[model samples]
Target chain A: MSSDVLVSVRGLEVHFPVRGEGIRKKGAGVLRAVDGVDLDILRGETLGLVGESGCGKSTLGNAVLRLIPSTGGSVHFAGTDVTSVGGKGLRELRRRAGMVFQDPFASLDPRRTVAQTVSEPLEVHGLRSGRRERAARVGELLELVGLDPAVAGRYPHEFSGGQRQRVGIARALAGEPDFLVCDEAIASLDVSVQAQVLNLLRRLQKQLGLTLLFISHDLSAVRHISDRIAVMYLGRIVEIGPASAVGSDPQMPYTQALLSAVPLPHPALERERKRIVLRGDVPSPSAVPSGCRFRTRCPYVFEPCDDVDPALQPAGAAGQQAACHLHGVVGTPVERTPEGVTAEP
Target chain B: MGARSGAPRGSEPASAVTAGTAPVLEVEDLRVRLRTPRGPADVVNGLSYTVGPGETVAVVGESGSGKSVSVLALLGLLPARVATVTGRAVLQGEDLLTMKPERLRQVRGPGAGMVFQDPMTSLNPVLTVGRQLVEGIRAHGDVSKEAARSRAADLLGEVGLPDPKGALDRYPHELSGGMRQRVVIAIALSNSPALLIADEATTALDVTVQAQIIDLIENLQADRGTGVIWITHDLGVVAGIADRVLVMYGGRCVEDGTVDDVLERPAHPYTRGLLGALPDLARPAVDGVVPDLATVPGTPPAPTDLPEGCVFWPRCPVRGDARCEHEQPPLVQIQGLDRHFGPSGLPHRAATWCTEPTSDTGLPASGTGSTALGGDR
Candidate 1:
């Protein structure tokens, strides 16, 4: 993996104000969606960001691409501050970085043909000059994502879920971006079809040498394509390391729990696996736990974990880092599950 | 093939489903044809399976493989005008498909319960959890509202929902996805149903929450002797929970066997392909590069335009076999009755022409696609 940083993020934070407009009155609080996240993407490596539903993984990914506004911190793309740029520079950043959204059904327009949908980026970025050129480029992009260009005339409704995802990929790659963020790209696809889309993304990444951020709730899919994996919780990344190192010998208790929770496909192995059943649900983002967000459900939570949130440091495994008190980086490592510990909502 | 896997499950007789007790739910020749805008579509075709007491029968398939439709059809959840369901579904000695509307409604709560994929949709938005739970309980019997209310709280407590009493007063929107799912499970178990149909129930939750919910369901099933029909596309979950696995393709049970007989020695080519597509976590990346996933080449056939013969023939990689193209293959026995399996008398059966050719078959590695998933399983 290349050490040259493609995208450098420092203390990136994205907070959403909970509004009680029409429906049930939600208490007024700032939901710290992406809170103080620091990460770096290698020049051509695929980094998988994994977490649960409300972990702000998607928010962090959007912040990296400047798709959504952030509350605090800075995002530097290609050695330049992406947060400061506006107008043409911002548009240029958008062109350089493409985002493939989660839902393919909602991402594409029902009225627009596949060609029109794919060429929208090319038109906006003014990549291909003429209509004929744009159509040709769209065809190339379609082929790049393993779609037949002949179906370019058809509407989005005519295609299957997997095919619609391929069209979405084609649109995301229209501007010839150096960086791509696939936010739950294959989550909506079927089990068999997910692999097809994942394979296509891996192939495209290799062919173009594009820096990729594949964000998904599914750890198995994330582990498959990512060279490096980052395990996020609530808002912060608890662990980041080489995919094999993290997937195999994870240092962080949260990472360990997350890995153990994933059900294996082998019956013998699955039955024999030691599953760490977390007590309660993920704490609400609006009311995140005092110090470490994961401490509420962490079985190995210590006194230091409740006071001082440990920052990412060199963990036990090589090239792996974890932000946990159990690392003994500062506090005593809590090896056993604390007794009589129960978290309340 | 390492067929003698010790099966490991026969030891715990109390919790584990026994060999030959009468099935809680027996579905035979089940078919559901829907009247879509295009035309009449056969969503489910000739499905057969049985779920004994405390048995977890997992129906594994892709999205439109009729996993969900079959369950919905049996429960009479599909709109009557749009659906044509013809099946023999005996749930707790009652025919779900042929029963009258009122009888089916009566059977839904105590006889058979369903926990759907989306918690937001399954629950009543306007009604509180306590009210809904009590209403379900009172509808079945002449219990007092106060008694039903306490019972509702007890059900919530049983489901491991925190502050069960306080949670009953709160709305579904107030709870997290995992919490909402717990409430749904609590309601599903309110009447102590003999069978529970969870259609992609934990798909919405994260891995950790999913595990908790799974454990809860397993424990509940063990205590109540409730047969579970778990409909999910996740092979990982099917591995952990299922006593019997039914691999569905194009609305048909392509393969049905014990976890070992299917997962370890997958008979049907489709099952093999499905297992091949999964990414095993135990697998290590080579030089920081994970191996390429093996994808089944094409998407599933749409219900409106299903193939004339074998539904999988259009995408089945094992092509040149003449029997595979024009004729629908029946469930052929892949392996005879294995004494090791906890649930007895059920052999490994695959509805494909490829089951007989075990030696030198072009099928992918039987377990997960990875090398680490090979013999260790």
Candidate 2:
């Protein structure tokens, strides 16, 4: 366990047991939602875990926090192996790692006031000295997320989508956790409000010096906020690199395709740029392809791609890593060009 | 095939009917106030814009900016008991606001059609996609059921749905989000309405699906000469489709111009902020944080509780003194460009007393010779 790493996940796998109704009597099959994966988040940096829906990004985040028990692998946070932690130890681990859910409306207890909702974490962690101290702390937390402390008395329903997200942020920060996992936090927000909340998160991350794992399908938002980005496909990291390098000069065909699909705000650029429309939908996690997970939809798939699963290897001008057969060719640096970087023909 | 071969020039008819000049849909001074228990609360106040035939006009604003409300009012879709609406929604010289219910119903499917956000909710779960599409066609036209069904399948095929016949049999729930949206589009185009109002129609779908839908709409509009009113908050969607852009804030038209004019050389402060705030993929990343993303602080003013003078003054980053606070800014013709604050006649132009020179602020040089945006009154 590295002390420098805030959260280190090693070959993490989460599988749900599915029972067969007619044919099979015993355990029928395992739904491999999260296949073997390894990732690490250093102190005070945002590690973006990005994938399409049902790619198990959320499941990975949940499993790491020990909200859901993993079928295999270890999650170590702050020099503690949390995979086997139970009861008090698990509670302590949870205190050091908090989760910010996707839907602010659904995640929050509607009946509870803002103060109560945020303070619940403090109470659960047994950090508060008294009711008065907890109240004050709640006020501070509210202020930290750019919400008025006076609004702490109000219910969640009274606030807008952006404000409710602020309250959710306040609650997540209540434990003063070293690591925070924001799972699609800004997905539900309006574009303008999304910007505000993202800026607020950036400010808070710097101020608190907190490590974060920001999970989202929004490539633009993820590229904006993440220091390092990990592109997930079928419960595997297909590419991992610095945000700028991955965004500007993507080596992976999948990453290039993903980036090209993002609509540019400017009319000139939007009309000018070529869009790569990937054929077919995202495959189900349970029945992933045998070799390369992305082989089913990858534009550059060759004969060898179906047979050999390429591990994530270094590519690009910078030391960006991508898992693709093209990059797997021996002693050949995948040259980056403006046309080559684009997914569209 | 005959219709395709002998079809009138797509762009000529709309331009010709109104002397090759008039807009397909011209909304002027539209106001919608809901009759609440307390009083009439103005949801959409004084909104105006035009959509040229075969051209797309986007109403860009945040959630409660009255973009949706104004369109709803135009369509006569709002429940009369709840909403008291006043405005001139003229479509090809016919005032929609004053039309009787029977006439409005006749106009609805054939004259104009609407595609709403959330295709899942908008579509009927119990009915097959075919049934719904045929129903829309039969409602407005004296067509046989078989003819409508074939037309429905053809429409679905036109929108790029695979195995249109099979898809038609499937209920809304059985289809993917993208497929369902296509079905909705098929229904919207069933009557072959001259105008299509899509209110956040593609917002619910993923980026790839959204691109497909936008392409479908653009293709259909080009082929059919259908005028489209695209209401959305996403600048990206607007950039892709709209020929003209209308920037709405607080139920008012702050800026209206060609896509290039509004997107590249945004004049209004609110417009500038919105453009600035959008995370530009082309821009170089700064310290892992995207730069030039400036957020307009404070929430949108509630319709029932709008501020005096400029409704945007409270949140406007460039707001100046008492004039902005006391005197309501009217949209005026600054140079040749007409800028109106509210939804009245194009004549009632409003430039803030504290207008700043266009050169210093990166605004387009005014042809109307109005004072700078931030100049003192």
TM-scores for candidates 1 onward, in order? 0.92, 0.89
State the lDDT of candidate 2 residue by residue for A52-107, as single tens digits: 77778999999988889999989888877888877888888878888889999899
In CAPRI terms, model 1 is classed as medium
lDDT values, one for every candidate: 0.83, 0.78
Q: State the iRMSD of every prediction, in order shown.
A: 6.0, 6.0
Residues A172-221 of candidate 1 have per-residue lDDT tens digits of: 88888999999999998887888889998999999999999999988888
In terms of lDDT, the poorest run of 10 residues in model 2 chain B is B1-10
Give the share of true interchain contacts found in each model. 0.73, 0.47
Best by lDDT: 1
Which runs in model 2 stand beyond 4 Å of their true positions? A17-31, A329-345, B1-21, B286-289, B336-377
